[model samples]
Target: MGNSEATLRVDNVTKRFGDFTAVEGLSFDVRAGRVFGFLGPNGAGKTTTIRMIVGITAPDEGKIELFGERMSPKMQDRIGYLPEERGLYKKMKIVDQLRYFAALKDVPQSVADKRIDKWLERMNLAEWKNKKTTDLSKGMQQKIQFISTVLHDPDLLILDEPFSGLDPVNVEFMIDVMSEFKSQDKTIIFSTHLMETAERLCNDILLINKSKKVISGSLREVKASYGKNLIALRAVGGEAMLGDRSLVAKATEHSDEIEIELAENADPQALLKKLIESGANISKFEKVEPSLNDIFIDQIGGVK
Candidate 1:
């Protein structure tokens, strides 16, 4: 048997379309009871990889195992997948649509009914239960789709861009629900380009670029590997400091602060001294860790 603690494993997987390679020699393990982030920019093979994971498409090479077994049709009921595309029945009542989806997963009416009512109330959709899905706002529709995905109480939940249309409030709501799922030991794979959300929510992350794995590990480990050479500085009249190539390699100015990337072998103390000598009023200057967004830029050659 495969490692019992592993919820999902992708081993040397590769997928191609015609002459283009979508995912190349990818390998990773998602442990049980953790939120795993699958991160990449647009057209970075994120969706294609997700498709292979849920068995919507077969890998051109290598293997994928879920719950220590090869992915098969029988496992569908145990997996809740929220695709990037929205596919709710436009005319169906929200509650009825949820019931229909739960039934497809082999959940009996008695259980589905109870779960549907509970989830709708929990998601604040109880008041809109009888409304047609097409009549709900984008955020509301997204929540309904999310409810349909998890109402069956699946063991593994795969969410692709789950926060795509959500407002800040709904985004937090989704995060809270995912946390609840983790507390229940339900494994989740969250795929998105929003590094900020992934940075905050995921226990482990796999960052891909150009169809290849760029980094993979616990968020702490991955950030630590990048080293702390970045400095966040907030000061007045430091525009000239940005051009000092000896003290700074690259500087990106923000509305209220500047992100300074130190050149290799440059000393932070010397940079600070130079700023002081330049008569710049420094408010915030600290050796801070790089955010996932910064790491993504560095890894992918500054591609947005």
Candidate 2:
């Protein structure tokens, strides 16, 4: 919501198959050049929603707009989509697969070849370019799939669980690549169950549970709205302060320290004074704001 230029808009979209409702009254806007985070648990209609946006399936109600126009083939060509299910031909050569996808996206063969070569070298897949996808490791295949996704250099990219199967190192590499794409003014939307990735990668987020939006906004705004002001203290004598229920809501203990959530009306300065007076050695006394993971659990976990 920081910028108002809508690159993609879903207005009260609802989708159904027979008697089952996949997405009901879902609405949100993805601004241009921003990394939008889509969050939901398993079977929460995240994929279905992505499909609707990409024009794989039309909504039974409502509408979708892309670049100020209704969804169309023109808009489709400008989109890069990586579905949740990995779909590369295991027997196909990496270079051939990239060429095929690039063709499908309307890139000329000559242009596709140069782009493929450059991306393979940049992504460390140069040696594997001619190898069959089956012979490559899962991580290698993932890198190829990513190359295919961006081979056409689409304006809008929709990634479903883009980080599903990767180690910490590759995940960090993917994060870096995503930022690079954003720097080039591409609009990226990705769905993830990993809150830490979203925390570091996304500029804005939409948290949905059971096909309903529970939270949406910038990270700072969402954390501030949680209205939680907490502080952690480490001390040999602060056990007495923990006994005073008026200053703290809950105290969770560790081997050598404790984290306490403070009541809203309790003055932070007053609590620090009391801790000092109780002869407690303050090791850490920083505000404990709610993280995206905490908010995700509270909102999605609270669903009926």
Candidate 3:
């Protein structure tokens, strides 16, 4: 899949509303069959960017290409978009809503019905198929929304905050669905504030801040690029040892561990030696990899 053409490409895209720029000079390529995470803080232009991708709005500058062609109405049926906001006709029956959505995408009623049955059953909403959408719990409603999104089996799925309002079990079910999509070679652009979820599902990520791209790369390379600057230490009295100006820049203490950020030029071995010398019962000392959450905060300049 390394040589597969990008499923979607945003080239030098920018969006301006009046005097404010929502997205500025953005560029990235999402490869086929890989789960891509689109992330940014609120008002950082993630929603605007998504709108442009879905053809809800046009970019003020540059261009977006999908399926190796310029983005257009004809290309939209190949993409399934689930917006961050929930919108359902509360008066509509659950199954009727699915049929209507499928019809909008040009799916025949018979085919839509079969696909709806399959998805509703898969989502454990088979029993609620005849119920009004307003009658279901928030979690059940979310499942219904999910069913509507995939009713036509679009090649690329854009999920914005897909796991919101789901219980733990439902969250797992959603994750499994995303993984299943991957197995079917369906590409996804997943957006969520759940850093751990993004880390688990996204093969690549594009992070934006202040309407600009901060970083974009494979997940492994992104984490590796941050380097092993964090240390996880478990020693009975070694918290005090983290105060050495030359070795430790900052330390966040947990009940049974200390997460130490190494000062520039500090050696992990030197920090361990100091902990031993301080008479602490050293149990563990190791270089820690920065997580997606860590990188997100660091890149956005939100870290203290």
Candidate 4:
């Protein structure tokens, strides 16, 4: 959490590809030093919105502002963008490629050199600095791309699926880096469909479906709005009772357990008593709030 001032604002923005509307009336704001989640499934126009924010394309309607002013060339360097797609010169050495990318942001040569090496060493890529990007693994290249994105130490970072191709370890490393940025009063706009990851990192989130804003708010507010109508149940031989619509609204299976949402006016005690009467071995049952995934299911009518 940080100041209430907005670092970026997308006001009533819309984009269309001819007759096909990609994004419509999308509006959200990222507060200073907060991780704002831009969440949606594939083809949800997340990329389109990102492109518009970064000035790769203009919104067909509405406007975007950064630091109280419209996006301009002079304001570009103040923000870092790590696009979902990989863009790197395969034949160029790691150090050279990073330096070149840094130069694009107008970072001085001396500063670029120090930042490049620091990032390389921090990510355990220093030994491979002389090697071409083609020689590194996909995971390594992704880290390099992230390094290049932050080399200029921009005030705002728009990371579009930054952890998409990374393994769990690398993903944590990226999360740590983003956390560090936040601690320094830098804001981040993280775009991803992984609700669990967003749950862990985001202070606020905007969930979209079919290019439309479905919900947007602080993570706590959104979850609290959905209420604590869920129960995480782990029981043997209770599967048959779960199908009773009078008690359960929905049940999505997770590994070795079931997340059950109670139907309107349904009693939690009744459901538990039914499981006990069924001679089931009940090990775990706890009332829990709806997860972001559960909320997404309600909004989008199913997983994408």
| Runs with alpha carbons beyond 4 Å of true place in candidate 1 | 1-4, 230-285, 302-304
Give the residue spans of candidate 4 off by over 4 A: 231-285, 302-304
Candidate-wise lDDT, in order: 0.89, 0.86, 0.89, 0.91
lDDT of 2 by residue, 46-143 (tens): 98898888888888999999988999876777999998897799888889999999999999999999999999998888998889988988888888
Per-residue lDDT of model 4, residues 21-135, tens digit only: 9999999988998999998878899999988888889999999999989977778898899999867898999999999999999999999999998999999999999999889
Q: What TM-score does model 2 achieve against the real structure?
A: 0.89
TM-score, every prediction: 0.81, 0.89, 0.85, 0.82
After superposition on all C-alphas, the RMSD of every candidate to the true structure, in Å, is: 4.7, 2.7, 3.7, 4.8
The sequence of per-residue lDDT tens digits that candidate 1 reaches over residues 187-276 is 999998888999999999999988999899999999988875889999987578778888799998888888899988899999999888
Model 2 segments more than 4 A misplaced: 236-259, 265-270, 273-280
**Candidate 3, 121-166: lDDT as tens digits:** 8887899989997799989898888888888899889999999999
Least lDDT summed over 10 consecutive residues: which range in candidate 4?
Answer: 295-304
Best by lDDT: 4
Candidate 3 local Cα displacement, residue 18, angstroms: 1.4
In model 2, the worst 10-residue window by lDDT is: 227-236
Q: Model 4 clash pairs?
A: none
RMSD of 3: 3.7
Q: How many steric clashes between backbone atoms does each model show? A: 0, 0, 0, 0
Clashing pairs in 2: none
